[model samples]
Target: MRTTNRPASGTVQSVDRAVTILELLAVHGTAGVTQLARELGVHKSTASRLVAALERRRLVEQVEDRGHYRLGVGVLKLAGATTARLDLAQEARPVCRRLAADTGETVNLAVLSGGAVLYVDQVSGTSTLSSYNWVGQHIPIHASSNGKVLVSELDGTELTRMLGELVAYTPSTVTDRALLEDELAQVRQRGFAVATDELDVGLTAVAAPVRDAHGDVVASVSVSGPSFRFDEARIAEILPLVRTATTEISSRLAHVPPER
Candidate 1:
Protein backbone atom coordinates (compact mmCIF):
# COMPACT_ATOMS: atom_id res chain seq x y z
CA MET A 1 0.00 0.00 0.00
CA ARG A 2 1.50 3.33 -1.07
CA THR A 3 0.91 6.50 1.02
CA THR A 4 -0.23 9.74 -0.72
CA ASN A 5 -0.09 13.24 0.74
CA ARG A 6 -2.98 14.00 3.08
CA PRO A 7 -5.62 16.52 1.96
CA ALA A 8 -6.21 19.86 3.71
CA SER A 9 -8.39 20.26 6.78
CA GLY A 10 -12.07 19.24 6.42
CA THR A 11 -11.37 17.68 3.02
CA VAL A 12 -12.02 13.97 2.40
CA GLN A 13 -8.98 12.28 0.90
CA SER A 14 -10.95 9.81 -1.26
CA VAL A 15 -13.18 12.51 -2.67
CA ASP A 16 -10.16 14.71 -3.34
CA ARG A 17 -8.37 11.90 -5.11
CA ALA A 18 -11.51 11.19 -7.17
CA VAL A 19 -11.70 14.82 -8.27
CA THR A 20 -7.98 14.76 -9.08
CA ILE A 21 -8.65 11.78 -11.31
CA LEU A 22 -11.31 13.72 -13.19
CA GLU A 23 -8.99 16.70 -13.54
CA LEU A 24 -6.28 14.40 -14.80
CA LEU A 25 -8.59 12.89 -17.41
CA ALA A 26 -9.78 16.37 -18.38
CA VAL A 27 -6.20 17.47 -19.00
CA HIS A 28 -4.99 14.28 -20.62
CA GLY A 29 -8.28 13.54 -22.51
CA THR A 30 -7.97 9.87 -21.58
CA ALA A 31 -5.90 7.81 -19.17
CA GLY A 32 -5.40 4.18 -18.24
CA VAL A 33 -5.97 2.94 -14.69
CA THR A 34 -2.22 2.22 -14.30
CA GLN A 35 -1.37 5.74 -15.50
CA LEU A 36 -3.89 7.33 -13.11
CA ALA A 37 -2.48 5.27 -10.22
CA ARG A 38 1.03 6.48 -11.01
CA GLU A 39 0.02 10.16 -11.35
CA LEU A 40 -2.04 10.04 -8.10
CA GLY A 41 0.79 8.23 -6.23
CA VAL A 42 -1.65 5.57 -5.07
CA HIS A 43 -1.93 1.83 -5.43
CA LYS A 44 -3.64 0.41 -8.53
CA SER A 45 -6.62 -0.84 -6.49
CA THR A 46 -7.28 2.59 -4.97
CA ALA A 47 -7.20 4.27 -8.37
CA SER A 48 -9.44 1.54 -9.79
CA ARG A 49 -11.99 2.16 -7.04
CA LEU A 50 -12.01 5.89 -7.71
CA VAL A 51 -12.41 5.36 -11.44
CA ALA A 52 -15.17 2.83 -10.88
CA ALA A 53 -17.06 5.24 -8.64
CA LEU A 54 -16.85 8.01 -11.24
CA GLU A 55 -17.80 5.62 -14.00
CA ARG A 56 -20.85 4.53 -12.01
CA ARG A 57 -21.94 8.15 -11.74
CA ARG A 58 -21.32 8.58 -15.47
CA LEU A 59 -18.71 11.24 -14.74
CA VAL A 60 -16.18 9.10 -16.60
CA GLU A 61 -16.58 6.57 -19.34
CA GLN A 62 -14.37 3.66 -20.37
CA VAL A 63 -12.76 4.19 -23.74
CA GLU A 64 -14.13 1.28 -25.76
CA ASP A 65 -13.62 -0.98 -22.73
CA ARG A 66 -9.89 -0.99 -23.46
CA GLY A 67 -8.83 -0.11 -19.85
CA HIS A 68 -8.83 3.63 -20.61
CA TYR A 69 -11.30 6.31 -19.52
CA ARG A 70 -12.33 9.86 -20.39
CA LEU A 71 -14.73 12.48 -19.13
CA GLY A 72 -18.35 11.62 -19.82
CA VAL A 73 -21.71 13.25 -20.50
CA GLY A 74 -22.37 13.69 -16.77
CA VAL A 75 -19.57 16.28 -16.68
CA LEU A 76 -21.31 18.20 -19.46
CA LYS A 77 -24.58 17.98 -17.55
CA LEU A 78 -22.97 19.48 -14.46
CA ALA A 79 -21.36 22.20 -16.58
CA GLY A 80 -24.73 23.03 -18.11
CA ALA A 81 -26.31 23.37 -14.66
CA THR A 82 -23.51 25.65 -13.50
CA THR A 83 -23.89 27.77 -16.65
CA ALA A 84 -27.63 28.02 -16.10
CA ARG A 85 -27.15 29.21 -12.54
CA LEU A 86 -24.66 31.85 -13.68
CA ASP A 87 -27.03 32.99 -16.41
CA LEU A 88 -29.91 33.18 -13.93
CA ALA A 89 -27.89 35.44 -11.62
CA GLN A 90 -26.75 37.67 -14.48
CA GLU A 91 -30.23 37.95 -16.01
CA ALA A 92 -31.87 38.83 -12.67
CA ARG A 93 -29.45 41.60 -11.67
CA PRO A 94 -31.20 44.50 -13.41
CA VAL A 95 -34.65 43.32 -12.38
CA CYS A 96 -33.52 42.89 -8.78
CA ARG A 97 -32.16 46.42 -8.76
CA ARG A 98 -35.39 47.80 -10.20
CA LEU A 99 -37.45 45.96 -7.61
CA ALA A 100 -35.23 47.16 -4.80
CA ALA A 101 -35.64 50.71 -5.96
CA ASP A 102 -39.39 50.43 -6.37
CA THR A 103 -40.03 48.68 -3.07
CA GLY A 104 -37.41 50.51 -1.02
CA GLU A 105 -36.36 47.13 0.31
CA THR A 106 -33.46 44.80 -0.25
CA VAL A 107 -34.00 42.36 -3.13
CA ASN A 108 -32.42 38.92 -3.36
CA LEU A 109 -32.19 36.03 -5.79
CA ALA A 110 -32.05 32.52 -4.28
CA VAL A 111 -32.01 28.93 -5.43
CA LEU A 112 -32.53 25.71 -3.50
CA SER A 113 -29.20 24.04 -2.77
CA GLY A 114 -28.52 21.02 -0.57
CA GLY A 115 -31.93 21.37 1.13
CA ALA A 116 -31.29 25.04 1.88
CA VAL A 117 -31.98 28.36 0.16
CA LEU A 118 -28.72 29.66 -1.28
CA TYR A 119 -28.74 33.43 -1.83
CA VAL A 120 -26.91 34.13 -5.09
CA ASP A 121 -27.41 37.84 -5.78
CA GLN A 122 -28.75 40.91 -4.03
CA VAL A 123 -29.43 44.64 -4.42
CA SER A 124 -29.86 46.96 -1.47
CA GLY A 125 -32.61 49.55 -1.35
CA THR A 126 -32.31 53.25 -0.51
CA SER A 127 -33.20 52.85 3.15
CA THR A 128 -30.80 54.26 5.72
CA LEU A 129 -31.08 51.33 8.11
CA SER A 130 -28.33 48.79 7.52
CA SER A 131 -29.53 45.47 6.12
CA TYR A 132 -27.82 42.14 6.40
CA ASN A 133 -26.12 40.83 3.25
CA TRP A 134 -27.51 37.35 2.54
CA VAL A 135 -25.62 36.60 -0.65
CA GLY A 136 -23.71 33.29 -0.45
CA GLN A 137 -25.53 32.47 2.77
CA HIS A 138 -27.68 29.37 3.18
CA ILE A 139 -30.92 29.65 5.11
CA PRO A 140 -33.33 26.94 6.10
CA ILE A 141 -35.84 26.16 3.38
CA HIS A 142 -38.83 26.14 5.71
CA ALA A 143 -38.17 29.53 7.28
CA SER A 144 -37.85 31.91 4.36
CA SER A 145 -40.19 33.37 1.72
CA ASN A 146 -37.58 32.87 -0.98
CA GLY A 147 -37.21 29.27 0.12
CA LYS A 148 -40.97 28.72 0.00
CA VAL A 149 -41.20 30.07 -3.54
CA LEU A 150 -38.26 27.91 -4.62
CA VAL A 151 -39.85 24.76 -3.19
CA SER A 152 -43.47 25.55 -4.11
CA GLU A 153 -43.02 23.80 -7.44
CA LEU A 154 -41.84 20.53 -5.92
CA ASP A 155 -44.14 17.56 -5.43
CA GLY A 156 -45.25 16.27 -2.05
CA THR A 157 -42.58 13.62 -1.62
CA GLU A 158 -39.76 15.84 -2.76
CA LEU A 159 -40.93 18.64 -0.49
CA THR A 160 -41.03 16.28 2.44
CA ARG A 161 -37.56 15.01 1.67
CA MET A 162 -36.15 18.50 1.14
CA LEU A 163 -37.40 19.77 4.48
CA GLY A 164 -35.95 17.15 6.79
CA GLU A 165 -36.92 18.78 10.10
CA LEU A 166 -38.83 22.02 10.64
CA VAL A 167 -36.36 23.79 12.84
CA ALA A 168 -37.75 27.03 14.21
CA TYR A 169 -35.50 30.04 13.77
CA THR A 170 -38.00 32.36 15.46
CA PRO A 171 -41.36 32.22 17.18
CA SER A 172 -43.10 33.08 13.93
CA THR A 173 -41.48 30.23 12.04
CA VAL A 174 -43.84 27.47 10.90
CA THR A 175 -42.47 24.33 12.55
CA ASP A 176 -45.42 22.12 11.84
CA ARG A 177 -45.17 19.90 8.81
CA ALA A 178 -48.90 19.98 8.02
CA LEU A 179 -49.15 23.75 8.33
CA LEU A 180 -46.07 24.25 6.18
CA GLU A 181 -47.59 22.01 3.54
CA ASP A 182 -50.73 24.13 3.49
CA GLU A 183 -48.61 27.26 3.21
CA LEU A 184 -46.72 25.77 0.29
CA ALA A 185 -50.03 24.99 -1.40
CA GLN A 186 -51.03 28.61 -1.03
CA VAL A 187 -47.72 29.71 -2.48
CA ARG A 188 -48.32 27.53 -5.54
CA GLN A 189 -51.90 28.78 -5.92
CA ARG A 190 -51.13 32.47 -5.39
CA GLY A 191 -47.84 32.34 -7.31
CA PHE A 192 -45.90 33.90 -4.46
CA ALA A 193 -44.94 33.55 -0.78
CA VAL A 194 -44.56 35.77 2.27
CA ALA A 195 -42.61 35.27 5.50
CA THR A 196 -43.08 37.64 8.44
CA ASP A 197 -40.56 37.37 11.25
CA GLU A 198 -40.16 33.76 10.29
CA LEU A 199 -36.43 33.56 9.76
CA ASP A 200 -35.61 36.44 12.12
CA VAL A 201 -37.53 38.63 14.52
CA GLY A 202 -38.81 41.91 12.98
CA LEU A 203 -37.85 40.83 9.47
CA THR A 204 -40.34 40.30 6.67
CA ALA A 205 -40.00 39.17 3.07
CA VAL A 206 -42.09 38.43 -0.03
CA ALA A 207 -40.93 36.30 -2.93
CA ALA A 208 -42.09 34.96 -6.29
CA PRO A 209 -40.80 32.10 -8.42
CA VAL A 210 -38.52 32.63 -11.38
CA ARG A 211 -39.12 29.99 -14.03
CA ASP A 212 -36.79 28.58 -16.65
CA ALA A 213 -37.56 27.87 -20.29
CA HIS A 214 -39.15 24.58 -19.24
CA GLY A 215 -41.46 26.49 -16.84
CA ASP A 216 -39.79 24.90 -13.82
CA VAL A 217 -39.09 27.15 -10.86
CA VAL A 218 -35.33 27.58 -11.08
CA ALA A 219 -34.98 30.34 -8.51
CA SER A 220 -36.83 32.94 -6.42
CA VAL A 221 -36.86 36.76 -6.39
CA SER A 222 -37.55 38.44 -3.07
CA VAL A 223 -37.86 41.80 -1.36
CA SER A 224 -37.20 42.10 2.34
CA GLY A 225 -37.13 44.74 5.06
CA PRO A 226 -38.20 45.50 8.64
CA SER A 227 -41.50 43.87 9.58
CA PHE A 228 -42.96 47.16 10.74
CA ARG A 229 -42.57 48.60 7.26
CA PHE A 230 -44.18 45.59 5.55
CA ASP A 231 -47.66 46.25 6.84
CA GLU A 232 -50.82 44.94 5.17
CA ALA A 233 -51.24 47.92 2.90
CA ARG A 234 -47.54 48.04 2.11
CA ILE A 235 -47.51 44.32 1.30
CA ALA A 236 -50.49 44.80 -0.96
CA GLU A 237 -48.64 47.60 -2.73
CA ILE A 238 -45.35 45.73 -3.19
CA LEU A 239 -46.77 42.33 -4.10
CA PRO A 240 -47.53 43.34 -7.65
CA LEU A 241 -44.06 44.82 -8.12
CA VAL A 242 -42.36 41.70 -6.88
CA ARG A 243 -44.51 39.49 -9.08
CA THR A 244 -43.84 41.68 -12.11
CA ALA A 245 -40.11 41.69 -11.52
CA THR A 246 -40.00 37.90 -11.21
CA THR A 247 -42.10 37.57 -14.35
CA GLU A 248 -39.69 39.73 -16.28
CA ILE A 249 -36.76 37.64 -15.05
CA SER A 250 -38.53 34.46 -16.08
CA SER A 251 -39.16 35.93 -19.49
CA ARG A 252 -35.51 36.84 -19.80
CA LEU A 253 -34.77 33.15 -19.16
CA ALA A 254 -37.00 32.34 -22.17
CA HIS A 255 -39.95 31.14 -20.13
CA VAL A 256 -43.14 31.34 -22.22
CA PRO A 257 -46.37 31.14 -20.29
CA PRO A 258 -49.07 28.80 -21.51
CA GLU A 259 -51.91 30.60 -23.32
CA ARG A 260 -55.22 30.56 -21.56
Candidate 2:
Protein backbone atom coordinates (compact mmCIF):
# COMPACT_ATOMS: atom_id res chain seq x y z
CA MET A 1 0.00 0.00 0.00
CA ARG A 2 1.20 3.50 -0.96
CA THR A 3 0.40 6.52 1.21
CA THR A 4 0.23 10.06 -0.23
CA ASN A 5 2.22 12.70 1.66
CA ARG A 6 0.21 15.83 0.99
CA PRO A 7 1.06 19.32 2.25
CA ALA A 8 -0.60 20.15 5.57
CA SER A 9 -1.74 23.74 4.83
CA GLY A 10 -3.55 23.48 1.49
CA THR A 11 -3.14 24.02 -2.25
CA VAL A 12 -1.95 27.65 -1.88
CA GLN A 13 0.76 26.73 0.61
CA SER A 14 1.85 23.81 -1.50
CA VAL A 15 2.15 26.07 -4.52
CA ASP A 16 4.14 28.67 -2.59
CA ARG A 17 6.53 26.04 -1.24
CA ALA A 18 6.88 24.44 -4.66
CA VAL A 19 7.74 27.81 -6.23
CA THR A 20 10.27 28.47 -3.46
CA ILE A 21 11.88 25.10 -4.13
CA LEU A 22 12.14 26.00 -7.83
CA GLU A 23 13.72 29.34 -6.92
CA LEU A 24 16.23 27.58 -4.65
CA LEU A 25 17.15 25.18 -7.44
CA ALA A 26 17.46 28.15 -9.82
CA VAL A 27 19.92 29.94 -7.53
CA HIS A 28 21.89 26.85 -6.45
CA GLY A 29 21.67 24.83 -9.74
CA THR A 30 20.73 21.71 -7.77
CA ALA A 31 19.75 20.98 -4.16
CA GLY A 32 19.19 17.96 -1.95
CA VAL A 33 15.97 17.55 0.05
CA THR A 34 17.75 18.42 3.34
CA GLN A 35 19.25 21.61 1.82
CA LEU A 36 15.91 22.71 0.43
CA ALA A 37 14.27 21.98 3.81
CA ARG A 38 16.83 24.20 5.55
CA GLU A 39 16.30 27.01 3.03
CA LEU A 40 12.50 26.71 3.30
CA GLY A 41 12.59 26.36 7.12
CA VAL A 42 10.45 23.21 6.83
CA HIS A 43 10.95 19.60 7.78
CA LYS A 44 13.04 17.43 5.47
CA SER A 45 10.05 15.14 5.00
CA THR A 46 7.90 18.08 3.84
CA ALA A 47 10.56 19.20 1.40
CA SER A 48 10.89 15.68 0.04
CA ARG A 49 7.12 15.44 -0.51
CA LEU A 50 7.01 18.84 -2.24
CA VAL A 51 9.95 17.88 -4.45
CA ALA A 52 8.22 14.61 -5.30
CA ALA A 53 5.08 16.44 -6.41
CA LEU A 54 7.11 18.86 -8.54
CA GLU A 55 9.05 16.00 -10.05
CA ARG A 56 5.82 14.27 -11.03
CA ARG A 57 4.72 17.48 -12.72
CA ARG A 58 8.04 17.63 -14.61
CA LEU A 59 8.91 20.88 -12.82
CA VAL A 60 11.89 19.27 -11.06
CA GLU A 61 14.15 16.33 -11.79
CA GLN A 62 16.85 14.44 -9.93
CA VAL A 63 20.39 14.07 -11.33
CA GLU A 64 20.27 10.29 -10.72
CA ASP A 65 17.91 7.74 -9.13
CA ARG A 66 18.71 9.16 -5.67
CA GLY A 67 20.48 12.47 -6.17
CA HIS A 68 19.93 16.23 -5.83
CA TYR A 69 17.02 17.75 -7.80
CA ARG A 70 17.28 20.49 -10.42
CA LEU A 71 14.79 22.50 -12.45
CA GLY A 72 13.06 20.61 -15.24
CA VAL A 73 11.39 21.18 -18.63
CA GLY A 74 8.18 22.49 -17.03
CA VAL A 75 10.08 25.60 -15.92
CA LEU A 76 11.02 26.24 -19.53
CA LYS A 77 7.40 25.72 -20.55
CA LEU A 78 6.22 28.35 -18.05
CA ALA A 79 9.01 30.71 -19.16
CA GLY A 80 7.87 30.31 -22.76
CA ALA A 81 4.33 31.30 -21.80
CA THR A 82 5.61 34.44 -20.06
CA THR A 83 7.80 35.31 -23.06
CA ALA A 84 4.84 34.87 -25.42
CA ARG A 85 2.70 37.20 -23.34
CA LEU A 86 5.46 39.82 -23.32
CA ASP A 87 5.82 39.50 -27.08
CA LEU A 88 2.08 39.91 -27.50
CA ALA A 89 2.11 43.11 -25.47
CA GLN A 90 5.14 44.43 -27.35
CA GLU A 91 3.62 43.65 -30.74
CA ALA A 92 0.25 45.21 -29.79
CA ARG A 93 1.74 48.45 -28.39
CA PRO A 94 2.28 50.27 -31.69
CA VAL A 95 -1.06 49.13 -33.02
CA CYS A 96 -2.86 50.34 -29.90
CA ARG A 97 -1.05 53.68 -30.17
CA ARG A 98 -2.16 54.10 -33.76
CA LEU A 99 -5.73 53.18 -32.91
CA ALA A 100 -5.82 55.68 -30.08
CA ALA A 101 -4.44 58.38 -32.37
CA ASP A 102 -6.89 57.59 -35.17
CA THR A 103 -9.95 57.44 -32.90
CA GLY A 104 -9.01 59.97 -30.20
CA GLU A 105 -10.15 57.46 -27.59
CA THR A 106 -8.39 55.15 -25.16
CA VAL A 107 -7.25 51.90 -26.78
CA ASN A 108 -6.78 48.66 -24.86
CA LEU A 109 -5.67 45.07 -25.51
CA ALA A 110 -7.46 42.50 -23.38
CA VAL A 111 -7.61 38.71 -23.08
CA LEU A 112 -10.04 36.36 -21.37
CA SER A 113 -8.58 34.77 -18.28
CA GLY A 114 -10.39 32.83 -15.53
CA GLY A 115 -13.78 33.85 -16.94
CA ALA A 116 -12.89 37.54 -16.78
CA VAL A 117 -11.36 40.13 -19.09
CA LEU A 118 -7.73 40.92 -18.30
CA TYR A 119 -6.40 44.16 -19.78
CA VAL A 120 -2.78 43.65 -20.80
CA ASP A 121 -1.93 46.91 -22.56
CA GLN A 122 -3.38 50.37 -23.20
CA VAL A 123 -2.70 53.70 -24.86
CA SER A 124 -4.52 56.86 -23.80
CA GLY A 125 -5.97 59.02 -26.58
CA THR A 126 -5.59 62.78 -27.03
CA SER A 127 -8.37 63.83 -24.70
CA THR A 128 -8.39 66.17 -21.72
CA LEU A 129 -10.93 63.94 -19.97
CA SER A 130 -8.91 60.76 -20.17
CA SER A 131 -10.41 57.47 -19.07
CA TYR A 132 -8.66 55.71 -16.20
CA ASN A 133 -5.75 53.40 -17.07
CA TRP A 134 -7.03 49.81 -17.20
CA VAL A 135 -3.81 47.92 -17.91
CA GLY A 136 -3.31 45.04 -15.47
CA GLN A 137 -6.92 45.28 -14.38
CA HIS A 138 -9.53 42.52 -14.57
CA ILE A 139 -13.14 43.33 -15.47
CA PRO A 140 -16.25 41.22 -15.59
CA ILE A 141 -16.94 39.52 -18.93
CA HIS A 142 -20.64 40.48 -19.14
CA ALA A 143 -20.21 44.25 -18.89
CA SER A 144 -17.37 45.23 -21.23
CA SER A 145 -16.99 45.33 -25.02
CA ASN A 146 -13.62 43.61 -24.93
CA GLY A 147 -15.10 40.88 -22.76
CA LYS A 148 -17.96 40.39 -25.17
CA VAL A 149 -15.61 40.03 -28.13
CA LEU A 150 -13.44 37.57 -26.24
CA VAL A 151 -16.35 35.45 -25.09
CA SER A 152 -17.78 35.32 -28.61
CA GLU A 153 -15.14 32.74 -29.44
CA LEU A 154 -16.47 30.16 -26.97
CA ASP A 155 -19.19 27.72 -27.91
CA GLY A 156 -22.55 27.72 -26.12
CA THR A 157 -21.77 25.02 -23.57
CA GLU A 158 -18.32 26.31 -22.79
CA LEU A 159 -19.66 29.85 -22.63
CA THR A 160 -22.36 28.84 -20.19
CA ARG A 161 -19.85 26.97 -18.06
CA MET A 162 -17.52 29.96 -17.96
CA LEU A 163 -20.20 32.53 -17.13
CA GLY A 164 -22.27 30.97 -14.38
CA GLU A 165 -24.28 34.02 -13.37
CA LEU A 166 -24.10 37.28 -15.30
CA VAL A 167 -23.55 39.91 -12.66
CA ALA A 168 -24.85 43.35 -13.58
CA TYR A 169 -22.43 46.21 -13.05
CA THR A 170 -24.76 49.02 -14.14
CA PRO A 171 -28.37 49.48 -15.15
CA SER A 172 -27.47 48.89 -18.77
CA THR A 173 -25.41 45.78 -18.01
CA VAL A 174 -26.75 42.56 -19.47
CA THR A 175 -27.35 40.05 -16.66
CA ASP A 176 -29.48 37.51 -18.47
CA ARG A 177 -27.50 34.57 -19.78
CA ALA A 178 -29.86 34.05 -22.75
CA LEU A 179 -29.71 37.72 -23.76
CA LEU A 180 -25.93 37.76 -23.38
CA GLU A 181 -25.75 34.70 -25.61
CA ASP A 182 -27.83 36.51 -28.21
CA GLU A 183 -25.55 39.53 -28.00
CA LEU A 184 -22.47 37.32 -28.43
CA ALA A 185 -24.08 35.76 -31.47
CA GLN A 186 -24.49 39.22 -32.95
CA VAL A 187 -20.90 40.03 -32.09
CA ARG A 188 -19.83 36.96 -34.04
CA GLN A 189 -21.87 38.04 -37.05
CA ARG A 190 -20.75 41.67 -36.94
CA GLY A 191 -17.10 40.87 -36.17
CA PHE A 192 -17.13 43.43 -33.33
CA ALA A 193 -18.83 44.36 -30.06
CA VAL A 194 -20.11 47.49 -28.35
CA ALA A 195 -20.80 48.25 -24.70
CA THR A 196 -22.39 51.59 -23.78
CA ASP A 197 -23.05 52.52 -20.15
CA GLU A 198 -22.71 48.84 -19.33
CA LEU A 199 -19.61 48.51 -17.19
CA ASP A 200 -19.95 52.08 -15.95
CA VAL A 201 -22.76 54.57 -16.36
CA GLY A 202 -20.81 57.04 -18.51
CA LEU A 203 -18.40 54.68 -20.30
CA THR A 204 -18.70 53.41 -23.87
CA ALA A 205 -16.43 51.01 -25.73
CA VAL A 206 -16.08 49.10 -28.99
CA ALA A 207 -13.88 46.04 -29.56
CA ALA A 208 -12.78 43.67 -32.30
CA PRO A 209 -11.21 40.21 -31.97
CA VAL A 210 -7.46 39.64 -32.31
CA ARG A 211 -6.49 36.27 -33.70
CA ASP A 212 -3.36 34.12 -33.39
CA ALA A 213 -1.45 32.16 -36.03
CA HIS A 214 -4.10 29.43 -35.95
CA GLY A 215 -6.95 31.97 -36.21
CA ASP A 216 -7.95 31.44 -32.58
CA VAL A 217 -9.30 34.56 -30.85
CA VAL A 218 -6.51 35.13 -28.36
CA ALA A 219 -7.34 38.71 -27.42
CA SER A 220 -9.33 41.83 -28.30
CA VAL A 221 -8.51 45.42 -29.26
CA SER A 222 -10.84 48.01 -27.75
CA VAL A 223 -11.44 51.75 -28.14
CA SER A 224 -13.17 53.31 -25.16
CA GLY A 225 -14.31 56.79 -24.18
CA PRO A 226 -16.99 58.78 -22.40
CA SER A 227 -20.51 57.89 -23.43
CA PHE A 228 -21.45 61.38 -24.59
CA ARG A 229 -18.43 61.45 -26.91
CA PHE A 230 -19.14 57.98 -28.32
CA ASP A 231 -22.66 58.52 -29.59
CA GLU A 232 -23.94 56.51 -32.55
CA ALA A 233 -22.41 58.76 -35.20
CA ARG A 234 -19.01 58.88 -33.55
CA ILE A 235 -19.00 55.10 -33.02
CA ALA A 236 -19.83 54.59 -36.68
CA GLU A 237 -16.79 56.68 -37.65
CA ILE A 238 -14.39 54.92 -35.27
CA LEU A 239 -15.51 51.30 -35.69
CA PRO A 240 -13.64 50.73 -38.96
CA LEU A 241 -10.40 52.09 -37.51
CA VAL A 242 -10.67 49.79 -34.49
CA ARG A 243 -11.26 46.78 -36.74
CA THR A 244 -8.29 47.76 -38.89
CA ALA A 245 -6.04 47.97 -35.85
CA THR A 246 -7.12 44.52 -34.66
CA THR A 247 -6.47 43.13 -38.15
CA GLU A 248 -2.98 44.63 -38.21
CA ILE A 249 -2.15 43.22 -34.79
CA SER A 250 -3.51 39.81 -35.74
CA SER A 251 -1.37 39.88 -38.88
CA ARG A 252 1.69 40.65 -36.77
CA LEU A 253 0.78 37.57 -34.70
CA ALA A 254 0.98 35.53 -37.95
CA HIS A 255 -2.74 35.08 -38.46
CA VAL A 256 -3.30 34.08 -42.08
CA PRO A 257 -6.57 34.88 -43.75
CA PRO A 258 -8.71 31.91 -44.75
CA GLU A 259 -8.75 31.27 -48.47
CA ARG A 260 -12.05 32.29 -49.93
Task: Say which candidate scores most in lDDT.
Answer: 1
| Model 2 CA lDDT for position 242 | 91
**Model 1 reaches what TM-score against the true structure?**
0.93
lDDT of each: 0.92, 0.89
Summarize candidate 1's per-residue lDDT along 1-260 as a digit string, tens digits: 23357676534988888889988998899999999999989899999999999999999998886899999899999999889889999999999999999888899999999999999999999972687889999999999999999998788889988989999889999999889989999999999999999999999999999998999999999889999999999999999999999999999999998999
Q: 117-147, model 2: which lDDT tens digit per residue?
A: 9999989988736468898899999899999
Best by TM-score: 1
TM-score of each: 0.93, 0.90
Positional deviation of residue 93's Cα in model 1 after best superposition, in angstroms: 0.9
> Looking at model 1, which ten-residue stretch has the lowest summed lDDT?
1-10
